[model samples]
Target: MERFFKLKEKGTDVRTEVMAGLTTFMTMAYILAVNPAILGTTGMDSGAVFTATAVASAIASFCMALFANLPFVLSAGMGLNAYFAYTVVAGMGYSWELALTAVFAEGIIFILLSLTNVREAIFNAIPATLKYGVSVGIGLFICFIGLQNAHIAVDSSTLVTIFSFNNSIKNGTFQSEGITVVLALLGILITGYLVIRGVKGNMLIGIFATWLLGIICQIAGLYVPDPDHGFYSLIPSGILSAPASLAPTFLKFDFASAFAHPLDFFSILFAFLFVDVFDTLGTLIGCASKADMLDEDGKLPEIKGALLADSIGTVVGSCLGTSTITTFVESSAGITEGGRSGLTAVVSGIFFLLALFFSPIFLAIPSFATAPALVIVGFLMIQQVVKVQWDDLLEAIPAYVAIFAMPFLYSISEGISLGIISYVILHVAAGKSKEVTPLMYVLAVLFILKYIAL
Candidate 1:
């Protein structure tokens, strides 16, 4: 294992890798509940989607381990699933099977792009300053996600507001929502303290400790299970269960129906391709930057393998009855936990497979428990902000745009697109057009066209 993973070379060991993997899986396991719920709205079987999510995630992570030797995990992506369910199936009046066909097509195209170095070229083309901005932007983006998951940031007239305990206080009855918010806050403090103390497996410990506290609160009747309000029992209902059959969604593609609407099918395919490319690239740049895995040229070594893993995972996921699978940003949780080798990915893949039988236990881990780890990891990632060349306005201005656009626009691809567009325009406007690469000009034009046309 050491020889294969270069554990010693990477300055990590078996125990640390194992803990990092577990931390990453725990933080990201919310996808098990979330993906099914989102895709179920399209009339697909939730059980089938759950099964596919686990199997596809495991396959992709293993691919990362074997092919790329990088500590990255892959799963059915959040926004892509939303596009699959709401935009394609519901809004466009397309069948779920047809949508799957579009995803499958996109994956095939991605594979070709990876093989031909198209994706790798794009990764290398982005300036180092923008790459740093992408890292910092993703950090803030992740922190925002953690806040939302814990309900610490609630929707309000101002767009977002902190959770309020006033209603429960006035009624003199503890509510699940208020309890979760409080526990999440406590969890953040506990996790932060553990990190400061240099606790081994601090992230994993924080998750379990927060969860144990919630279980205790539930037992004391202070926290109630309110499925309607997104709060559930902290204790597992069962130790194990049979994995759900994939028959309902397996190999369920409708290419004939999809091709009948040629224009619409092409549009859907393009959307999947464009978003998956940029999202995967942004995540790779951000997480790789966080792990110090980028080369002197701001390019990740063995990147083609990572892109191939993601592309293949998307194809396999679509065949297995899920949306496009791609490298997850949550992998930063493991990276922040000192995971620098593929052994971490291997361990994560094994846990994803284990989740099939231990769904009850894994699913019982509430979002509040894992929110702290993400928040902490986000803090770690943002330290890269100081590396940006702030004095160079030409670089600094575009980097700033990319950094803020991610969390505010809620899309990594959107942030990169706007950043590239701004970068090219700024360089050209300043008569420094020689600094912009030809590929970058093409990318900027394409992104602008994407906004206007798609």
Candidate 2:
């Protein structure tokens, strides 16, 4: 292990790597519950999604270990999954099978780009401020999703409003909606406190703790199961269960259907590719920097292998019926714990594989329980807002538009579209056309045409 992973040179040991990997797994394990919940909203089988999530995560992380020899782990990305389910399938009204095909295509494109300088050029083409905006926008979008899942934000005459305990009281359904909302709020507080205390795996602990509380409420008769209204039993049928069959979602791509809608297919493909490229690059850079793994050029070593691992993960995940898999920023948790080699990733991957056997535990976790983790993760992602050059209106305005457009418009692609178009137009209007990259101009024109033509 020492010779293979260069533990002595990297100043880390097998034990340290093992601990770091476990730390990484604990930190990110919330996705085992959250991914299925998010994707299940798109009519996918929750059990199958749970299985797919675990299997895809394990495969991707293992690839990260063996291919890149980096400490990074991979999984179906949070925002990309949202774009797949909410934007492509729900908003654009595409079948989930076709959406999978787009993901498969994106992965193939990523593989090509990873083999050349094209990916780097595209990464450099987008302004850093806009990248920060996209991150913040996705953060807000995820937080909004958490709120909706918990029913903390409910539909109203004004379009959105808080869940009303008073209304539930009058309607005598307080045991269902009101209690769940209250528990969700309490879960947020609990999770926030855990974060404040600098707890490792705070989000995961928050999820389990909140879920346990709900179970207690059900036992105490304070919260009642209303399967008719989407509430169901919180208790697992058993503590141990076999992994669900992936037959429901496995290898379910509909390439023909996707290709028939050429324009829409490419649009969805671009959205998946654009977000996955930047998100994976950003995460790798951030985590590598945290681990002091970058060279003098501020670039990660073995990045091609890393990108290949990530792209391959996406393709494999799509084939296994999941969304785009990418390097996770949560791997930074392991990095902070002295993980500097792929052994750490290998350990995390092992944990993911082991998680497959615990499907009942993960699946029994309700959306409300996972809601706090999503909100907390969103808060973590939103911290990138500080990196944006807020003083420069040219940069800030487009960033702002992108940031708000996502949750407001309820579409990640729309947010990217408006952000790029506004950025290019504002720069040209201000006689700063020289500052805009040729690629940016092309993207802006394409997005403009997308709106006009599609």
Candidate 3:
């Protein structure tokens, strides 16, 4: 195992890798329930989605370990799945199958881009300042997701809101009334404390601790359990079960219908492709940086392999009945756990496969448990902000735009698009037009056309 994974060379051992893998899995296992919940609203079978989520995540992470030999895990992304179900299917009136077809098309495009130098060129063209910004932005984005998932930060109709502690004390929402916001707070505190004290596998310990507390609260009637509701209720039931049939959503893409309208078809395809591309780029850079895997030039080695793993995963996921498959930002938690070799990804893949049969056991872990890991990861990632040159407006403003736009707009693609466009304009206005590459101009125009299409 050491020879295969180069464990000594990477300065990590099997035990550390295994711990990192478990840490990564615990932080992201919420997707098992969350993906099915979101996609189920679009007519896909919940059982099928559950199976697809596990299978796709396993396959993608397996490829990342075997092919790319990197400590990255891939799964169906949170934001794009929402775009697929809500924006494409519900809002645009397209069929779910048609949306899958678009994902498949995007995967094909990604593969081609990876095969050529196009993908690498784009990754290299992204300035270091913007790269640092992307890292910090993704950190904030992950924290926002953690808070929202835990229901600690509630969103009003127009703006995002937070749970009221005063209200919790004085006849405000609790247990049956609220989504266990106090539990989430406790989780954050416990996990943050462990992380600050440099505890090994702090994230996993925090999650399990929080989950145990949740169960205690449920039994004590301080937290009500709702097994029949669509939401995840932290209710524990059976430990293991047979894997669900994937027949409902497997290979269900309707390419014929998706291609019926050329303009809209290509537009949707571009949306998926662009979003997947930049999302992968941002995540790869961010996680690799955390692992100290980047070279002196701030470039990821074997990046094409990593990108191809993602592209291939997306295609396989489309065939198996899910949305786009991409490297997760949550993998930062694993990197933080001393994972530097592909063995980390391999262990994570194994955990995902195991989830296929023992899903209920894994799913029983409440969002409040996992949310703390994400919050701590956000803190870890945002430290890159110190590397940015804050004195230069030409660089600072664009970097800040990239950093803040992600959480504000709720889309990594949109944030990157805005950042790239701003970067080009700022450099050009400052008589440094020569600094902007040809790829930047192309991306700026494409992003403009993309928004115009909407």
Candidate 4:
């Protein structure tokens, strides 16, 4: 019984594990918006969506710690959220309520697939190149999603107009919002400086630095509200009524639409399941690989538990109105920040849960503040392009399409779809059809139907 968690035999400390969980959560701090905005386009009230994100993330993170036993944190996937908001709601014209319904159904299907072992099997069947492409694609997709959320770019006729105060704010006549932007840039600079200097806990330090700047903004009377409202910002919980009031919608299910379009709902379900499982696996394996968390047998400890918790989190989050929940890849950023073990995740989760009380604070930090981080993470995501052996179109074309399609298509699923189809087509066209594995063909067919033909 004690061997179940590796605690009794591996000699784990409960407090240390809790701290590890907390640390993992912090790396995911950006997710508070990633989920709701996607869900928000489905027509939910923004405030209500924010409140729901807080509660759902809290529940999901808790489950990740208690059940998964892996040093991973669960939040709204960045790319997934963009798809939810931009593609599902805005592009596809689905109601926010219906999108939530779709995401929930996907969660149910994921549970069934996990139970049947089909989820893992399907993942194992995918080509190694596709795996690498999808993983890298998701990172670029995240940065693109982040940038759009922060409103750093606006679409226009032909080229686009980018928002920037850089070199524009001079002579002491700066926009009020400029203050937030400067502090955010300061956060990015500090984080980069720390990384360059071999500093530990740089992410924590950066967040703290920005948080302190936020405080300074408050003291300087930047966000003073009407005195009639008593100069206090409305905590999202005050609107939702807090701890207990959250229970009603936290895991509430909406199966009405599933009955209306069973097949469509199921297709999206398969999509969600496919993306979440591999995304979680990729994130865990990536970070664990970097941290040397894998054992001599090349197996990561607590990975199965982590996956189990991740599957459970999706089920839980759907009921709470968020999209499919999964482990985040940005935990590598925390690994870069020198977090070891589950303590990292626990810290990150605790911050996410606590963030509910300060929705205004998170909201207060404007998009301009986060834009630079988006740019940085985007560059970081595309770093995998170096691994694509340009000498061979077999590797280069599909990988390039996967990397570029993310932001251009504005959908993670679509980016993956294009990448897969291109891989199969290029491999066959280049006389490498014999190398085109059957499983690749299966995925390629599905990708084509969902994204291209469908």
Best by lDDT: 1
Q: TM-score per candidate, in order?
A: 0.99, 0.76, 0.95, 0.74
Q: Against the hidden true structure, what lDDT does model 2 obtain?
A: 0.81
Q: In angstroms, how far off is 311's CA in candidate 1?
A: 0.4
The weakest ten consecutive residues by lDDT in model 1 span 167-176
Off by over 4 Å in 1: none
lDDT of 4 at 394: 80
List runs of model 2 lying over 4 Å from the truth: 1-50, 65-103, 170-173, 246-306, 322-348
- Structure candidate 2, residue pairs in collision: none
Error of 2 at 352 (Å): 3.6
- A best-first ranking of the candidates according to their TM-score comes to 1, 3, 2, 4
1-454 per-residue lDDT for model 1 (tens digits): 9999999988999998998898889988999989999999999999999999999999999999888999999999999999999999999999999999999999999999999999999999999999999999999999999999998988899999888788656368878888888899999999999999999888889989999999999999989898887788899999898899999999999989876889899999999999999999999999999999998989898799999999999999999999999999999999988988888888888998999999999989999999988888889889999989999999999999999999999999999999999999999999999999999999999999999996
Give the winner by TM-score: 1
Cα lDDT over the full model 3? 0.86
lDDT of 4 by residue, 248-304 (tens): 345444567667877766665565666666566556644555455656544555655
Candidates in order have lDDT scores of 0.93, 0.81, 0.86, 0.59
Cα error of candidate 2 at position 307, Å: 3.9
lDDT of 4: 0.59
Instruction: Give per-model CA RMSD.
Output: 0.9, 4.7, 2.0, 5.4
For candidate 1, what is the lDDT?
A: 0.93
Q: Once model 2 is optimally superposed onto the true structure by TM-score, how far is the C-alpha of residue 18 displaced, in angstroms?
A: 7.7
lDDT per residue for candidate 3 within 393-426, as digits (tens), equals 8888888999999989987777888999999988
Better of 3 and 4 by lDDT: 3
